[model samples]
Target chain A: MIEEITSTQNAKVKKWQHLTTKKGHQKFHQYLVEGWHIVSDALAAEQPVVQIIATGEQLDAHQRELPENIETFEITPEIAKKLSDTVTPQGIFAVMDILASETIDPETATGAWLLLDRIQDPGNIGTMVRTADAAGFRGVVFGNGTSSRYTPKVVRAMQGSQFHIDLTHGNLEDWVKALEARQIPVYGSALNDQAEDYSTVTPQADFGLILGNEGQGMSERLMTQTTTNLYIPIKGQAESLNVAVAAGILMFKLNQKLA
Target chain B: MIEEITSTQNAKVKKWQHLTTKKGHQKFHQYLVEGWHIVSDALAAEQPVVQIIATGEQLDAHQRELPENIETFEITPEIAKKLSDTVTPQGIFAVMDILASETIDPETATGAWLLLDRIQDPGNIGTMVRTADAAGFRGVVFGNGTSSRYTPKVVRAMQGSQFHIDLTHGNLEDWVKALEARQIPVYGSALNDQAEDYSTVTPQADFGLILGNEGQGMSERLMTQTTTNLYIPIKGQAESLNVAVAAGILMFKLNQKLA
Candidate 1:
């Protein structure tokens, strides 16, 4: 039904805003998604969409394609703007239940896994998830200080990779130890003098590659716990690389080692 | 010299705003820089520093290290806030001369060169430059419709690669033709049946790899000009990658071919 929402005081508006906070996201296990591309991607992934709100114009453009049982409503432009985190709202929003996090059952471990250590930028985190998904990584784990996977900017940038990977948030040390316990080698990238060149490292059929913060990189304690330290050699003038770019290069190159 | 700049018409204030425009940066042959890391990197790169401005308590903390030849000024907190593009000014700003874009004579291009075709995000462009620099690309060219190299955000994101590479902005088609004339293989990344897997095709020592716009990717006309079309095989659930990340994978892998 085309329901008109004009008041900023609407319960839905407040709930969407709450999704912006990590506590709200964790407590409710839901995320707010905006724009046509994200909404379309989420639906196509068969995510448990709690509700769909569209502007009158947007509904006219898209209603014919929506599922009959979907909870859809046509909201006012003002209401849509209030619910949007983007500078230019696309006149659509969705409340989606969190995708089930992938369980690290050792019995099913066969491919590579990506571990993010305190990656702070939401955009970088989202891009990494997208790249990891494109490269066919088994799953992604966010360490302490990492951006929340449910942040709006991340959700927008990820497009739809959220549903495709087993995403988990935990302490890096504990996760590495857990992976170690399972007989998986844990490798962390370091700018250390003696680290093996990243291109030279062979990817284990079952391994965890840890990427660290943009500034501090992998913490000293975490770096010490890794079975091996990998370094991407710099041949030109940049002292370092953007964390996401470096991680993507390593993930793709490491995958090649298997082939 | 401490000067209270109340009027928005002040010469220095006007110059700061002008740097935002391409015409202004071209006329002055320099641009504004913001924040501590960018300013520090620019200084450490030993670029020609025209001036440094600081304000508030942070100015006191930063003043002891000011070099004699470089001009220095102190602005009121209000003035600094007005001049800053960022939400929180880090009590520092610098004006540096733009490095002259020296053309890479075609005969000397013995390594991978990045040919960007209308890539637009400043952060994406900057990140690509840093990655290209790290991968030992000969240079990075900003083709038609690309963002200016001197934009503050691009310069900051580059983290000083601008001082280290041949970053030129001009006719991309002409450059493509020139490289082809020299028998240097120009590989265009495109989605076409003619495209071979990027890993399958060994890059010639003399090669120019072309990247396209973020949205449309390589244009049909540009694809026609390529010596060959190459594709990075996507094995996962995501549709595609951020253009810069894709470029990094190509640049680094292609550089490895030469190594």
Candidate 2:
């Protein structure tokens, strides 16, 4: 039903807010997506979207192209402003069920996979996913303490790469062991002197490159479990590269072998 | 001289606000750098600081660590807050002189360089500088109406890499011609079908990798001047990668051959 929304206290508005927040995302097992670009992407991917809410002006703007099967609601700019997290709301938002991503059988994969450890910033996590997708990575696994994969900032930063690849969250040790069992080599990044230049590591038939957090590099416990610790040589005066940039560099280099 | 900063109308506080506006940055040639980590990074880089101002309490907390050569001043917390750009300023702020970047005799350097075209985000520019530093790029040249290299967000995002590298802003044509004269191949990125995969272009003795804006790719004028127009292979669904990430990948791959 395309109902008109007048009040900010409407149940639908509260639901949208919840979908945007952590508790709501966890309780409902769904997250909010903003902008017509993201909503259009979700529809194009045939992903399950619970609801679509847009302003009268926006709906008119998108009416010719919006799919008929999806449920939609109309709200005023005031209602939309209140519902949006952005200062300049894109006049559209959607609630979609979180996709269930399982560990890939590395034995069958042809490209590299990404392992993110305690990568705190949502923007970094999102951008890394986008980079990984562009570099032809098979999937991305979030180890213990990484940002929520479904956070709005990350999803936006990823620019819909989330829909294109497998994204999983689980224990670090088990994931490493799983890759090993499949004969896939896993490399951890470390700041130590013994670490080989990242380019030196030949990306295996199916390999995983782990990137750590912003403040700290890879955790000592996680580092010890990996096959090798790799380092990107820093030629300039900066202390270290941002984790996402480092991951992008590694992923790109690994893909070069296949190219 | 330690001054009492009671009102937001104080000359220094006004300058901080001015840094936010384009005319202000143009007129003053100064920008704000917020947060403790960034300020500490600037100090560590030994960037010339014209004024180092902090609250009396903050001075008490970090007085000994302040550089002996730099001038220091203490203001009230209220005054410090007025001069700050962030919601929660770390109680330290400084006015640093912008470094004058020298032109590279593109003929002499047989290394990788980055040319940014109309990429507006300051954070992206800063992150790209950090990535360029990590990948051992010779320097960065900005053209095509991009944000100033010295913007506050770029400064904070750069994490002090700006101090360690050469960054210039000006015409794109001359730089390309200079590099070509030196026999250095320039690879410009675009989405055209005639463009080869980025993997196909071997990094010559010296090379220029051009990254375009987020919305617009490379301009036709600049593309025509490039030795080769190339595209990064997007194996999956992503239309493109972040410019910074794309640059990082290209630089890493090119530099690996040299390393």
Candidate 3:
């Protein structure tokens, strides 16, 4: 079914405008993804995309590829601009169900996992997710204070990597305890006397790596809970590495051929 | 010496405003850096900080620490906003000379260097430069299409890394040729059957690593001219790593230790 929305104040348009915020996505349990690439990726991944919204021209361009079972709406440029977060709207969007993520038990968990604590930057969060995907990690746990994956800014920066891996919201403290109970080494990144030099730690078949806030290192409680903390020996005068960059180096180094 | 400027229309104030653009910065051979942190770092590095501009409140806060020889201007908050690039003006700025970067002869270049081609994003450029600093690289060369490091957005994102290492603008192709001529391996990053896995290459004491535009890989002309090209294995579905992240991974991996 297809409908035309000429006015910005239309009921459906107002509802979508709300999906631009985290609060709205949480309240309605739906998320909006913009641009052609992401929309097409969502469809390709067989995500639960319920609706397609586009300008008449964009709808005409993409109509043939869109799933016929999904409802479609042709909206005016005004409404498109009003709902867009980008400087120029791509004139297309997909409304998706925010599927609840299931928890993975550490006792049976295999492969590597990344745990982020209090990572507030959307770009950092999204980049880390993408890096984790590229590094072939099993999943990423967003600890408290870390921005939700549903945040529109993170969704945009993620560039579609969210669908490629598992993302779960959890308390990092509990995660550390659970992983440690199973004897899966959980490593926190920090620079201290006791921290093992990262390169010296052989690639592991199963592990959990923790990264924290941009300004602060890992939380005191979480840092103390890990099996051991790892440090990338800083050879230069730079105080530290960017959190996302550090995540990439550590994930690739530790997750090599997770057997 | 201190000068009080009450109005935005003051001749000197108008000139400082001009430094906000590339052309303006080029014409004057000077650039403006905001915030107390940058200003102090510039002073600490003895980087030819000719003038300091700050609001009365900020000037009062930082007065005792400022050098006696450099000229200081106490401007109103209105003038500070006029010259600030950030939403909330830090109310402080330093004007520094754009020192001409002498060409480095590859024969004598001892440490790893990063060469960038067509990297237009300011944040990516700044982040790469900082990563090079953290990885203990000797310098970074901006090829033709990369935004100048003097751009206000790049300067701000660079934090203080700009002062810690050398920044040179040059042709990446020439850099590849020069390094190879000196028996130093110049590596290009590309994913192909023939490209050696990045991890297989042992950390080197002297080499050049080339990164290109975010979307496009290294230029065809440059790719074929390298000593050899390297590839970071992407074990999962992510198409590619963020340019800044890739640069970080490569720099740290190759420049692990100078010896």
Q: Which candidate gets the maximum DockQ versus the true structure?
A: 1
Supply the TM-score for candidate 3: 0.94
Candidate 3: give the clashing pairs.
none
Encode model 3's per-residue lDDT on A117-160: one tens digit a residue. 99988989999999998889988998999987887778887787
**Candidate with more favorable, higher DockQ: 1 or 3:** 1
- Could you list the chain B TM-scores for each candidate? 0.86, 0.87, 0.95
lDDT tens per residue, model 2, A2-36: 88998999987888888877888889889999888
lDDT of 2 at A212: 90
Off by over 4 Å in 1: A99-109, A257-259, B1-11, B22-29, B44-48, B56-65, B98-110, B203-205, B257-259
Candidate number achieving the greatest lDDT relative to the actual structure? 3
Which window of ten consecutive residues has the lowest lDDT sum in model 1 chain B? B101-110
Better of 2 and 3 by DockQ: 3
List, for all models, the DockQ compared with the true complex. 0.66, 0.58, 0.65
**Model 2 regions lying over 4 Å from their true place:** A99-111, A256-259, B4-9, B35-46, B76-88, B99-111, B256-259
Local accuracy of candidate 2 as per-residue lDDT tens digits, B57-143: 777777778776766666677766676655776787777765554455554655778888898878789999988877778788888
Q: Candidate 1 chain A — worst ten consecutive residues by lDDT sum?
A: A101-110
